[model samples]
Target chain A: MAKRLMPLLNRVLVEKIVPPAKTHAGILLPETSNKLDSGKVLAVGPGLRDKTGNHIPVAVKEGDTVLLPEYGGTTVKLGEKEYHLYRDEDIMGTLHD
Target chain B: MAKRLMPLLNRVLVEKIVPPAKTHAGILLPETSNKLDSGKVLAVGPGLRDKTGNHIPVAVKEGDTVLLPEYGGTTVKLGEKEYHLYRDEDIMGTLHD
Candidate 1:
Protein backbone atom coordinates (compact mmCIF):
# COMPACT_ATOMS: atom_id res chain seq x y z
CA MET A 1 0.00 0.00 0.00
CA ALA A 2 1.11 3.50 -0.77
CA LYS A 3 1.92 5.63 2.26
CA ARG A 4 0.25 8.89 3.09
CA LEU A 5 2.07 12.04 4.03
CA MET A 6 1.86 13.58 7.51
CA PRO A 7 1.83 17.35 7.87
CA LEU A 8 3.26 18.55 11.17
CA LEU A 9 6.48 19.12 13.00
CA ASN A 10 8.16 16.13 14.71
CA ARG A 11 5.52 13.67 13.55
CA VAL A 12 6.04 10.54 11.46
CA LEU A 13 3.47 8.49 9.62
CA VAL A 14 4.25 4.81 9.41
CA GLU A 15 2.47 1.97 7.65
CA LYS A 16 2.29 -0.85 10.19
CA ILE A 17 3.26 -3.91 8.22
CA VAL A 18 3.42 -7.15 10.13
CA PRO A 19 6.94 -8.10 11.16
CA PRO A 20 8.53 -11.42 10.17
CA ALA A 21 7.10 -14.43 11.97
CA LYS A 22 10.38 -15.56 13.56
CA THR A 23 13.09 -14.02 15.66
CA HIS A 24 16.88 -14.23 15.26
CA ALA A 25 16.76 -16.88 17.98
CA GLY A 26 14.60 -18.94 15.58
CA ILE A 27 11.64 -18.83 17.91
CA LEU A 28 8.21 -18.68 16.32
CA LEU A 29 6.51 -15.42 17.16
CA PRO A 30 3.04 -14.13 16.54
CA GLU A 31 1.59 -10.79 15.61
CA THR A 32 0.78 -10.10 19.23
CA SER A 33 4.41 -10.41 20.13
CA ASN A 34 5.75 -7.39 22.02
CA LYS A 35 9.01 -7.51 20.17
CA LEU A 36 9.95 -4.38 18.25
CA ASP A 37 11.57 -4.35 14.83
CA SER A 38 12.83 -2.02 12.16
CA GLY A 39 10.55 -0.58 9.54
CA LYS A 40 10.94 1.39 6.36
CA VAL A 41 10.51 5.08 7.08
CA LEU A 42 7.43 6.07 5.16
CA ALA A 43 7.10 9.75 5.95
CA VAL A 44 8.57 12.25 8.39
CA GLY A 45 7.87 15.73 9.58
CA PRO A 46 9.96 18.87 9.15
CA GLY A 47 11.59 18.44 12.57
CA LEU A 48 11.30 19.46 16.19
CA ARG A 49 11.21 23.06 17.32
CA ASP A 50 14.47 24.18 18.75
CA LYS A 51 14.70 26.16 21.98
CA THR A 52 14.93 29.43 20.08
CA GLY A 53 11.67 28.63 18.19
CA ASN A 54 13.48 27.66 15.00
CA HIS A 55 12.94 24.24 13.45
CA ILE A 56 15.69 21.75 14.11
CA PRO A 57 16.29 19.46 11.15
CA VAL A 58 15.44 15.80 11.42
CA ALA A 59 18.34 13.33 11.43
CA VAL A 60 16.48 10.56 9.59
CA LYS A 61 15.27 10.53 6.00
CA GLU A 62 12.58 8.56 4.24
CA GLY A 63 13.29 4.87 3.49
CA ASP A 64 15.62 4.30 6.43
CA THR A 65 15.24 1.23 8.64
CA VAL A 66 14.34 2.63 12.05
CA LEU A 67 13.79 1.10 15.47
CA LEU A 68 10.56 2.26 17.14
CA PRO A 69 9.45 2.19 20.74
CA GLU A 70 6.84 -0.30 21.89
CA TYR A 71 4.24 2.19 23.06
CA GLY A 72 2.73 5.71 22.79
CA GLY A 73 1.96 5.96 19.08
CA THR A 74 -1.52 6.80 17.95
CA THR A 75 -2.77 3.95 15.80
CA VAL A 76 -5.02 4.63 12.84
CA LYS A 77 -6.35 2.60 9.94
CA LEU A 78 -5.91 3.76 6.40
CA GLY A 79 -8.19 1.84 4.05
CA GLU A 80 -7.41 -1.73 5.15
CA LYS A 81 -3.96 -1.15 6.60
CA GLU A 82 -3.05 -0.14 10.12
CA TYR A 83 -0.63 2.71 10.57
CA HIS A 84 0.92 4.72 13.38
CA LEU A 85 1.49 8.43 13.70
CA TYR A 86 4.08 9.39 16.29
CA ARG A 87 6.67 11.96 17.11
CA ASP A 88 10.12 11.57 15.62
CA GLU A 89 11.63 11.52 19.10
CA ASP A 90 9.77 8.28 19.70
CA ILE A 91 12.09 6.64 17.18
CA MET A 92 14.95 4.95 19.03
CA GLY A 93 17.66 4.48 16.44
CA THR A 94 18.47 3.57 12.85
CA LEU A 95 19.10 -0.11 12.35
CA HIS A 96 22.61 -0.63 11.07
CA ASP A 97 23.90 -3.85 9.51
CA MET B 1 18.91 6.19 45.77
CA ALA B 2 21.49 8.45 44.20
CA LYS B 3 21.77 8.19 40.41
CA ARG B 4 24.88 7.38 38.49
CA LEU B 5 25.86 9.22 35.34
CA MET B 6 26.35 7.67 31.93
CA PRO B 7 29.06 9.02 29.70
CA LEU B 8 28.12 8.96 26.02
CA LEU B 9 26.34 10.85 23.33
CA ASN B 10 22.53 10.74 23.30
CA ARG B 11 22.41 8.59 26.43
CA VAL B 12 20.18 9.31 29.43
CA LEU B 13 20.80 7.68 32.78
CA VAL B 14 17.61 7.08 34.71
CA GLU B 15 16.76 5.49 38.00
CA LYS B 16 13.94 3.01 37.31
CA ILE B 17 11.61 3.97 40.09
CA VAL B 18 8.40 2.00 40.17
CA PRO B 19 5.42 3.78 38.69
CA PRO B 20 2.39 4.88 40.69
CA ALA B 21 0.15 1.98 41.51
CA LYS B 22 -3.09 2.95 39.77
CA THR B 23 -4.06 3.98 36.27
CA HIS B 24 -6.44 6.73 35.23
CA ALA B 25 -8.86 3.92 34.49
CA GLY B 26 -8.82 3.20 38.23
CA ILE B 27 -7.04 -0.09 37.90
CA LEU B 28 -4.29 -1.00 40.34
CA LEU B 29 -1.27 -1.93 38.30
CA PRO B 30 1.94 -3.56 39.40
CA GLU B 31 5.54 -2.90 38.48
CA THR B 32 5.33 -5.43 35.62
CA SER B 33 2.26 -3.70 34.23
CA ASN B 34 4.15 -2.49 31.14
CA LYS B 35 2.77 1.00 31.67
CA LEU B 36 5.16 3.82 30.98
CA ASP B 37 5.48 6.83 33.23
CA SER B 38 7.21 10.10 33.89
CA GLY B 39 10.50 10.23 35.77
CA LYS B 40 12.74 12.86 37.21
CA VAL B 41 15.43 13.46 34.69
CA LEU B 42 18.71 12.62 36.41
CA ALA B 43 21.30 13.03 33.69
CA VAL B 44 21.33 13.51 29.93
CA GLY B 45 23.89 13.33 27.19
CA PRO B 46 25.31 16.29 25.35
CA GLY B 47 22.99 15.40 22.47
CA LEU B 48 22.85 13.48 19.23
CA ARG B 49 25.23 14.08 16.37
CA ASP B 50 23.47 16.01 13.68
CA LYS B 51 23.75 15.29 9.96
CA THR B 52 26.44 17.97 9.74
CA GLY B 53 28.63 16.17 12.30
CA ASN B 54 27.93 18.76 14.96
CA HIS B 55 26.49 18.15 18.40
CA ILE B 56 22.83 19.06 18.50
CA PRO B 57 21.68 20.49 21.83
CA VAL B 58 19.38 18.44 24.03
CA ALA B 59 15.85 19.70 24.53
CA VAL B 60 15.52 18.28 28.00
CA LYS B 61 17.25 19.37 31.20
CA GLU B 62 17.85 17.62 34.50
CA GLY B 63 14.72 17.38 36.73
CA ASP B 64 12.22 17.47 33.91
CA THR B 65 9.43 14.91 34.05
CA VAL B 66 9.77 13.01 30.81
CA LEU B 67 7.87 10.22 29.12
CA LEU B 68 10.11 7.29 28.29
CA PRO B 69 9.56 4.54 25.77
CA GLU B 70 8.64 1.12 27.08
CA TYR B 71 11.62 -0.77 25.70
CA GLY B 72 15.09 -0.53 24.12
CA GLY B 73 17.06 0.75 27.08
CA THR B 74 20.10 -1.15 28.32
CA THR B 75 19.41 -2.07 31.92
CA VAL B 76 22.15 -1.68 34.47
CA LYS B 77 22.36 -2.05 38.20
CA LEU B 78 24.46 0.36 40.21
CA GLY B 79 24.70 -0.67 43.83
CA GLU B 80 21.27 -1.97 44.87
CA LYS B 81 18.98 -0.36 42.32
CA GLU B 82 18.27 -1.05 38.66
CA TYR B 83 18.56 1.80 36.20
CA HIS B 84 18.36 2.32 32.47
CA LEU B 85 20.73 3.91 30.06
CA TYR B 86 19.19 4.82 26.71
CA ARG B 87 19.38 7.29 23.89
CA ASP B 88 17.56 10.58 24.25
CA GLU B 89 15.54 9.85 21.12
CA ASP B 90 13.82 7.07 23.04
CA ILE B 91 12.20 9.73 25.21
CA MET B 92 8.71 10.48 23.91
CA GLY B 93 7.91 13.81 25.54
CA THR B 94 8.04 15.91 28.69
CA LEU B 95 5.11 15.36 31.00
CA HIS B 96 3.21 18.59 31.49
CA ASP B 97 0.37 19.29 33.84
Candidate 2:
Protein backbone atom coordinates (compact mmCIF):
# COMPACT_ATOMS: atom_id res chain seq x y z
CA MET A 1 0.00 0.00 0.00
CA ALA A 2 2.85 2.35 0.76
CA LYS A 3 4.03 1.93 -2.81
CA ARG A 4 0.83 3.35 -4.24
CA LEU A 5 0.27 6.81 -2.71
CA MET A 6 3.10 9.27 -2.47
CA PRO A 7 1.97 11.69 0.19
CA LEU A 8 2.43 15.24 -0.99
CA LEU A 9 4.51 17.79 0.86
CA ASN A 10 4.33 17.47 4.60
CA ARG A 11 1.37 15.11 4.44
CA VAL A 12 1.45 11.80 6.22
CA LEU A 13 -0.37 8.63 5.30
CA VAL A 14 -1.87 7.34 8.54
CA GLU A 15 -3.41 4.00 9.46
CA LYS A 16 -5.80 4.61 12.29
CA ILE A 17 -5.26 2.36 15.32
CA VAL A 18 -8.48 1.02 16.63
CA PRO A 19 -8.50 1.69 20.33
CA PRO A 20 -9.01 -1.29 22.57
CA ALA A 21 -12.62 -2.31 22.92
CA LYS A 22 -12.68 -0.20 26.07
CA THR A 23 -11.61 3.26 27.12
CA HIS A 24 -9.17 3.99 29.93
CA ALA A 25 -12.20 5.03 31.90
CA GLY A 26 -13.53 1.51 31.43
CA ILE A 27 -16.26 2.26 28.96
CA LEU A 28 -16.87 -0.35 26.30
CA LEU A 29 -17.14 1.08 22.81
CA PRO A 30 -18.67 -0.78 19.91
CA GLU A 31 -16.86 -1.55 16.67
CA THR A 32 -19.26 0.52 14.58
CA SER A 33 -18.39 3.55 16.70
CA ASN A 34 -16.16 6.49 16.00
CA LYS A 35 -13.77 7.94 18.58
CA LEU A 36 -13.07 11.29 16.90
CA ASP A 37 -9.41 10.89 17.94
CA SER A 38 -7.09 8.03 17.10
CA GLY A 39 -4.40 6.90 14.64
CA LYS A 40 -0.84 5.78 14.06
CA VAL A 41 1.72 6.96 11.55
CA LEU A 42 2.04 4.72 8.56
CA ALA A 43 4.12 6.86 6.23
CA VAL A 44 5.23 10.45 6.54
CA GLY A 45 5.88 12.86 3.72
CA PRO A 46 8.82 15.14 3.25
CA GLY A 47 8.28 18.01 5.62
CA LEU A 48 6.75 21.31 4.60
CA ARG A 49 8.72 23.52 2.30
CA ASP A 50 10.52 26.44 3.80
CA LYS A 51 10.57 29.87 2.21
CA THR A 52 13.75 28.83 0.44
CA GLY A 53 11.84 25.91 -1.15
CA ASN A 54 13.81 23.47 0.93
CA HIS A 55 12.08 20.61 2.70
CA ILE A 56 11.68 21.00 6.42
CA PRO A 57 11.96 17.82 8.48
CA VAL A 58 8.92 16.18 10.05
CA ALA A 59 8.86 15.71 13.80
CA VAL A 60 7.20 12.29 13.90
CA LYS A 61 8.57 9.32 12.04
CA GLU A 62 6.95 6.13 10.76
CA GLY A 63 5.72 3.72 13.48
CA ASP A 64 5.19 6.54 15.94
CA THR A 65 1.88 6.70 17.79
CA VAL A 66 0.20 10.04 17.21
CA LEU A 67 -3.04 11.81 17.85
CA LEU A 68 -5.13 13.17 15.03
CA PRO A 69 -7.73 15.87 15.04
CA GLU A 70 -11.19 14.35 14.93
CA TYR A 71 -12.48 15.88 11.72
CA GLY A 72 -9.59 16.65 9.44
CA GLY A 73 -7.98 14.62 6.67
CA THR A 74 -8.51 13.31 3.15
CA THR A 75 -9.78 9.74 3.31
CA VAL A 76 -8.71 7.33 0.63
CA LYS A 77 -9.58 3.69 0.27
CA LEU A 78 -6.87 1.64 -1.36
CA GLY A 79 -8.21 -1.75 -2.38
CA GLU A 80 -10.01 -2.72 0.85
CA LYS A 81 -7.66 -0.77 3.14
CA GLU A 82 -8.68 2.67 4.40
CA TYR A 83 -6.12 5.36 4.99
CA HIS A 84 -6.07 9.06 5.71
CA LEU A 85 -3.83 11.62 4.07
CA TYR A 86 -3.26 14.73 6.11
CA ARG A 87 -0.67 17.43 6.66
CA ASP A 88 1.74 17.35 9.57
CA GLU A 89 -0.04 20.31 11.10
CA ASP A 90 -3.17 18.19 11.50
CA ILE A 91 -1.33 16.06 14.02
CA MET A 92 -1.90 17.21 17.56
CA GLY A 93 1.10 15.63 19.29
CA THR A 94 2.93 12.39 19.80
CA LEU A 95 1.50 10.15 22.41
CA HIS A 96 3.68 9.76 25.47
CA ASP A 97 4.78 6.49 27.03
CA MET B 1 -24.18 28.25 21.05
CA ALA B 2 -20.97 30.03 21.95
CA LYS B 3 -22.26 30.35 25.47
CA ARG B 4 -22.36 26.58 25.83
CA LEU B 5 -18.90 25.47 24.72
CA MET B 6 -15.92 27.40 26.07
CA PRO B 7 -13.59 25.68 23.58
CA LEU B 8 -11.02 24.85 26.29
CA LEU B 9 -7.72 26.27 25.01
CA ASN B 10 -6.34 26.93 21.58
CA ARG B 11 -9.39 25.11 20.26
CA VAL B 12 -12.00 26.54 17.98
CA LEU B 13 -15.68 25.91 17.65
CA VAL B 14 -16.06 25.60 13.91
CA GLU B 15 -19.30 25.76 11.97
CA LYS B 16 -18.62 24.05 8.68
CA ILE B 17 -19.38 26.25 5.69
CA VAL B 18 -20.96 24.07 3.09
CA PRO B 19 -19.27 24.55 -0.24
CA PRO B 20 -21.41 26.46 -2.72
CA ALA B 21 -22.90 23.22 -4.03
CA LYS B 22 -20.10 23.43 -6.60
CA THR B 23 -16.36 23.32 -6.79
CA HIS B 24 -13.95 25.72 -8.46
CA ALA B 25 -13.43 23.01 -11.05
CA GLY B 26 -17.21 22.98 -11.65
CA ILE B 27 -18.02 19.86 -9.70
CA LEU B 28 -21.31 19.81 -7.89
CA LEU B 29 -21.48 18.29 -4.39
CA PRO B 30 -24.46 17.12 -2.42
CA GLU B 31 -25.54 18.40 1.00
CA THR B 32 -25.50 15.05 2.83
CA SER B 33 -21.96 14.56 1.63
CA ASN B 34 -18.75 15.15 3.53
CA LYS B 35 -15.94 17.10 1.88
CA LEU B 36 -13.27 16.36 4.50
CA ASP B 37 -12.02 19.90 3.96
CA SER B 38 -14.56 22.65 4.55
CA GLY B 39 -15.60 24.85 7.48
CA LYS B 40 -15.88 28.37 8.87
CA VAL B 41 -14.83 29.50 12.31
CA LEU B 42 -17.82 30.01 14.50
CA ALA B 43 -15.93 30.68 17.75
CA VAL B 44 -12.28 30.50 18.64
CA GLY B 45 -10.61 29.39 21.85
CA PRO B 46 -8.23 31.55 23.82
CA GLY B 47 -5.13 30.01 22.19
CA LEU B 48 -2.32 27.61 22.94
CA ARG B 49 -0.40 27.89 26.15
CA ASP B 50 2.91 29.63 26.12
CA LYS B 51 5.89 28.42 28.09
CA THR B 52 4.83 30.71 30.87
CA GLY B 53 1.36 29.18 30.82
CA ASN B 54 -0.02 32.41 29.41
CA HIS B 55 -2.51 32.24 26.59
CA ILE B 56 -1.01 32.56 23.18
CA PRO B 57 -3.22 34.48 20.80
CA VAL B 58 -4.97 32.83 17.88
CA ALA B 59 -4.24 33.95 14.34
CA VAL B 60 -7.82 33.81 13.06
CA LYS B 61 -10.79 35.34 14.77
CA GLU B 62 -14.42 34.37 14.69
CA GLY B 63 -16.17 34.31 11.32
CA ASP B 64 -12.98 33.64 9.44
CA THR B 65 -13.03 30.87 6.87
CA VAL B 66 -10.52 28.11 7.51
CA LEU B 67 -9.56 24.67 6.26
CA LEU B 68 -9.93 21.74 8.60
CA PRO B 69 -8.14 18.44 8.63
CA GLU B 70 -10.54 15.70 7.46
CA TYR B 71 -10.45 13.32 10.42
CA GLY B 72 -9.46 15.22 13.52
CA GLY B 73 -11.49 16.85 16.29
CA THR B 74 -13.98 15.87 18.96
CA THR B 75 -17.53 15.90 17.72
CA VAL B 76 -20.15 17.25 20.03
CA LYS B 77 -23.82 17.50 19.30
CA LEU B 78 -25.11 20.41 21.29
CA GLY B 79 -28.86 20.57 21.04
CA GLU B 80 -29.80 20.15 17.38
CA LYS B 81 -26.56 21.68 16.06
CA GLU B 82 -23.44 19.69 15.28
CA TYR B 83 -20.08 21.23 16.13
CA HIS B 84 -16.48 20.06 16.21
CA LEU B 85 -14.22 20.86 19.15
CA TYR B 86 -10.55 20.63 18.34
CA ARG B 87 -7.25 22.02 19.47
CA ASP B 88 -5.42 24.88 17.77
CA GLU B 89 -3.03 22.37 16.29
CA ASP B 90 -5.94 20.86 14.38
CA ILE B 91 -6.41 24.05 12.41
CA MET B 92 -4.36 24.01 9.22
CA GLY B 93 -4.29 27.66 8.17
CA THR B 94 -6.44 30.72 7.77
CA LEU B 95 -8.05 31.34 4.43
CA HIS B 96 -6.64 34.30 2.54
CA ASP B 97 -8.46 37.29 1.11
In terms of DockQ, which candidate is strongest?
Answer: 1
Q: Supply candidate 1's per-residue lDDT for B59.
A: 69
B53 in model 2: Cα distance from truth in Å?
25
Q: Score each candidate by Cα lDDT.
A: 0.64, 0.68
- The Cα error of candidate 2 at residue B26, in Å, is 65
- Residue-level lDDT tens digits of model 1 in A1-97: 5446564787777655466577678878655543444456778888775555655666567776665566778876767777777777666555444
Best by the TM-score measure: 1
- Model 1 Cα displacement at B37 (Å)? 22
Q: For each candidate, what TM-score against the reference?
A: 0.48, 0.45
DockQ of predicted model 2: 0.03
Off by over 4 Å in 2: A1-3, A23-35, B1-97
Q: What is the TM-score of chain A alone in each candidate?
A: 0.73, 0.76
